[model samples]
Target chain A: MAGLSDLRAGFDPATVKEDFTLLRNPHHDHPLVYLDSAASSQRPDSVLAAMDDYYCRSHANVHRGVYRLAEEATSLYEGARQKIGDFIGAPDPGREIIFTKNVTEALNLVAQSWGRANLRPGDAIVLTEIEHHANLVPWLMLASEIGFEIRYLRLGEDGELDLSRLEETVEGAKLVGVTMCSNVLGTLVPVSQIAQAAHAAGAVVVADGAQYVPHLPTDVSSLGADLMAFTGHKMLGPTGIGVLWGKAEILDAMPPFLGGGEMIKDVRLDGFIPNDLPWKFEAGTPPIAEAIGLGAAVDYLSGLGMAAIREHEITLLSYAMKKLEADHGDALVIHGPSRPERRGGVLSMQLDGVHAHDLSQVLDSRGVCVRAGHHCAKPLMRCLGLAATARASFYIYNDESDIDALSDALGEARSFFA
Target chain B: MPGLEDLYREIILDHYRNPRNAKELESPPALRAEGYNPLCGDEVVITLLVDEGRIQDIGIGGQGCSISRSSASLMTVSVKGKTLEEASAAIRSFKAMMSIHESSLAPAASQTETPTAAELAKMGELAALQGVVKFPVRIKCAVLAWNTLSECMAKATDAQP
Candidate 1:
């Protein structure tokens, strides 16, 4: 199996760390240790180079103009679709991929376009209490607009999705969409189980693979998802480029999201006709260079087997949780799921005394970075009885030693009040 | 590091271990205010015993960081017998000091926003936390209590003669 170091010429974590010249602060000489991969992944040199190469060589309008530049641009752009399709294990690249701005936009595209068209006044959109605002808001907007009832699957004591209540929540629902892995709770939902439930309810299942695809071997068929949306930035690619993959039959059934240049086959003065499959949803100038970078990121991630990445992250999470418990046992309250393998890689915690904002500040003072906020899941926050949590997430680059540093900082914070 | 200077400084730990005034006050005459940091959900309630124009007493109730809780504690202890106008002026001085006017710390500009009761309590010793301005991320922690004080004042004053 290919590993991280084998992917590149010299991908040494020690020697080839991120050269973030743009991310420097004046106070500290020590290298900033960033542990907030759930928020955004640091782009590797390869992703940057791939984008720079695309801009340098073939930078032209795709699907427009008959010249060689346009043809090349169109091929490269279409080629990214194939790459993304292959990366996510979608068989039909042509029908399976629609490039979006981000996961949020892709989810919104499904909600506004598909939900608006398919769901009527009485139809229901079943979601979980732990959904990020990206996945929840669009459906909410649709539900309010079209009068579709919204039901949420509650969480269990284990911080996992209450699979027992799945039928009750999703029964008679028109659509059931949920996250594969949580950004805050770090709990990994059973996508296959959810899909089975939704399918039994005669509802289409859309998976928020934003947190899943980056860490797991995501085969859309095996996962049984009708639609899946994810972002490039969180998976170590350039920002502003994301993917929305759906089953061909499902894609055919949904109405177009946006209309313009490339999403049409024929245009008349009266009304234009929709293009075939994926192109029907991808309107106007797509993020060409960012797509190329995402394709490169996919190559990089794939080269390092997703299983290995998952294993590494689980080990880090377990070690971090253990260390935190051992040291700050009396004071710290970790949110989401504690079981490492059950979750993805997010570790959101709140110290007993220190506010998350203050905790994040103290941690940042020591060059240990973490995200502290409501994390765009107000409903989840309410579920957990917390307004915000200080989150420290991990990825392939993060190791057990990083967890030690985090634990040390946290211990220091606890002792600061001792 | 109590013996050898740990990563967590002594002052910070002392503040966190024993939070000050973590309780509620009786209603009426107390300018009830709540300071909340929406970012972290650190909340503090402030109650002031304002007799005529003078501050008879002040106390706080809430949860938060060592800095926020400690600052609230210090504020309650510091602002006894100060007049409401004096307290309001002090709040103006503290806010200006913390926000932008650190170097000179004199009157840089007059008050633009109408401060509530909680906002008024944020003045005085609270101004000492001006160092938090340097860390933009932690600025909210420093102001969480102050904001609560302003809110308390606002709610109290709004219902007053």
Candidate 2:
């Protein structure tokens, strides 16, 4: 509901850039033009300060100690869970959120825990062709072990999911996994619609919100996801922290993914009873400082306003697409949905005469940081008939000037190769 | 802080544009091996015919970046007429120039052990890829072809009497 005018009034990239120390420092000759938020976003000073404050003042192993410092650490760690849950509109914050290494771990936890418990030899799980390796591999690994059928929804020419066979694919599927946004194509998928179809077919929907949660406003319940996975680092938080949010009953029913320390209620030599909802899944020592950092990132993002951030990115996407098309014409191709509103701020592009790696190398020399690889979505890359793509994904810190720098560098790269 | 000029030399670009032996040979007569830089999905397939302990023919296949394609071209040309041992020596020598010493476990060896001028003289046009040593990540691109060639050579010769 937030307008572009609100974006201009409140959110300013120039002002935001001042908060990141790395942005001020030049990579070589030019200041760092980071457009790789989809891989991982740059952290602001506030997130860094939060982590530092935690390490410096209140560092302790969470949940066990009766001391005030340990209690404080536990509170900070649990408080982060609450804020992140609220940020994503989880129905039950304390019980539904499970901390993992990253979204990859989070997805694997779901596949190992809920999937192993539910899946059988005759069962089938529906997945999309455009899922990142994180989403696809876990399910594939699980299916390979359990000998269940895996059906993939095909991709359309316009980079959207081919949902014509959605009903057929989900007909007897136990679970349906879908990415909310394509990291390579920047395509924004209609999760709610997919969820509706999946639900109608009596299938549970597991959403990959890695690319979506960072840029768009997310309400997991409204989105109709039974369970979801997203990472902290891609949303201006530190690495080593990820989140998996599921329905309370679903998480409660599932067995523990990993068992060692904090995950159990009582562990005898013979058997162990798992702990309550969230902690039941969190095994061993958790990333406490990283969680606090994520809390700060959530606070920062909330202050900026998710709607305004989305609007800012939309404006940036429109500008960049128009400029690139006008400048390069047929020589350059941008994948995914043509309409700016239909996609996120990610641009997966190819130059006619140059390979993506070479193009990215040239851009790197110009202090532009775009990812030039399969983007960890090799199946999607293979589907697109590309070995790799030079991806430039925008974040809240990026502006039109960064896009201009990209355009200029692309021109230079083309001529240099030519 | 190596510049783009260091990574993409004119010779390297020339080889990339007009690659040598960029084809696949028939499977019965030629042995094939493939290499992949999983980081970028850059793949190189090497097919070669071995006869009387010498490489008779070589072909390059698969798709990759300018560096990888060109390196494959250069590698195919360099080892086409050499014996298996000689070709492996060339690979070792090339890897050495890239500061990947096979024997040393010390991390400092890669940084400190620069290829000598004598070693560079023996490498010919392949020496141009010495700049890749300065950029650690692209060394995989430069060496991808050699690695595949080594594999193909091993399998081809092993299949013979």
Candidate 3:
């Protein structure tokens, strides 16, 4: 079987891991084994340097600056937009990409601006059972105000979406909000297929690509999503910057989400003329340094090649799964698809009688950092009949050694509890 | 050994493995309050049986981590026979022991000036949880049951008259 060694022929995770200064944290006696990339990935030196360079060299608020330094800063920020937009295959980079605080804000922008204008009373918005609160809560909040019925696409016992009743679920739905990948379960939902179904049902497809875009090769055109949201931090970039990619016409049609400086073309005494497609949405003086950092992150990922990155994760995930199952047997139960090919490098594991909190504490002693909680998916937690699970997620920087450390820690935790 | 052992003390593990009053009290006699740690998905339900300004009986029913479940178990045992005022004092003392701030230790503020063996004995087994202050994130888990108990008492008081 192709493992990390076989797949990462030229790519060295150790070398890549070294670029991230946080990975070398001296707080623990043992080496830090960070497996919580699904939450927010650590930024590499290149990303950090890029942001630092921006602040040192081109320190100015974007969009309204006329000075040379301001222009340079604007170029750096917008240039990032173009690079990121191209990286994700946004149809029109200049018009489609809107920057927000994070994926949560991006999703909120869609819910508040697009959803409010389009949705009516008794209109349905189709959402998956496994969506993060970022994707789920916005629509729910909007529904309460707009009086639209929210329908959920339930997950099967196998942890994948039960799409057998897709047509029935999307019936009378105006918008279908779903996650491209499950952060907790690591199950990869076929976004393109879901989008096709949603489109056929006369519903717009809005995808939360917070998890997917980081690991997978994303092409918005092929995915057929009307709008998609993802954060920079999860994709090896800095926090406080997120991307909301939408169709140009759709973005142009929607009202400005927040009325602030850069988002306006003209503010009359009576009413205001909203800015063009993308700017109309990006209200405030955006995360300039963070966006530049995101641009550098994109460059780094492009250098590594997204396909190879995906392959590396698949190889590592498969190895981890096999090793864990062999070592622990019935003691450790992994959630999501049995096959690693069908999932990302996220393993939400349950160690029989050991509480996730207890397991996390024990693991922390060995310098293995894993998230232990409902993973902001309370609905999915209810579906799985679990209060919480210990989630160990991986990224391009992670390899088999980290997984081995994780397994060893889990064994120790089990013994300690026993 | 100091850190991990301090966190998962034997007493805490004992309470977690074998919880006290780990069942729902009959509704007519019990006033119930639910506590949820949304971050960890720890849900604790505390039921109180108050009789003439005293805690006649208490029951804890919930699903949570060892810290939370064990805390609930210990809380039920500690407050069972005490008057509401005394139980509240015990709660205050336990909270003081787990508190990082000097202000939170208001009830036993004078004890800080001179550490007495008597004050230590007053806390009893709840002193096992004093180590929890080190782990700030898990402190909420240790207090989930106590917070719920406070809510249950409030509800019971509100129901009267």
Best by lDDT: 2
Q: Model 1: per-residue lDDT, tens digit, A100-194?
A: 99999999999988887899998888998889899998988877788879998888877888878788788999889899998889899888888
Q: How does residue A287 of candidate 3 score in lDDT?
A: 84
Better of 2 and 3 by lDDT: 2
By lDDT, the better pick of 1 and 2 is 2
Give me the candidate number with maximum DockQ: 2
How should the candidates be ordered by lDDT, best one leading? 2, 3, 1
| Model 3 pairs whose backbones collide | none
Residue ranges of candidate 1 with Cα displaced over 4 Å: A1-27, A266-270, A326-331, A336-338, B1-21, B25-36, B44-62, B71-84, B100-124, B148-161
For each candidate, report its DockQ versus the true two-chain complex.
0.35, 0.88, 0.71
Query: How many angstroms is residue A142 displaced in model 3 relative to the true structure, after the best TM-score fit?
Result: 1.1
Higher DockQ: candidate 1 or 3? Answer: 3
Residue A83 of model 1: what lDDT? 91
Worst 10 residues of 1 chain A by lDDT: A6-15
In the range B1-161, model 2's lDDT, one tens digit per residue, is 77889888998999999999999999868898889999999999888988888999999999999989988999988998999889989999888887776676658745567778987888999988888888888889888988888888889767877
- Residue A284 accuracy (lDDT) in model 3: 80
Relative to the real complex, the DockQ score for model 2 comes to 0.88
Please give the clash total of every predicted structure, in order: 17, 0, 0
lDDT of 3 by residue, B80-143 (tens): 9998888888777777666633365356655454324687678777777767878889999998
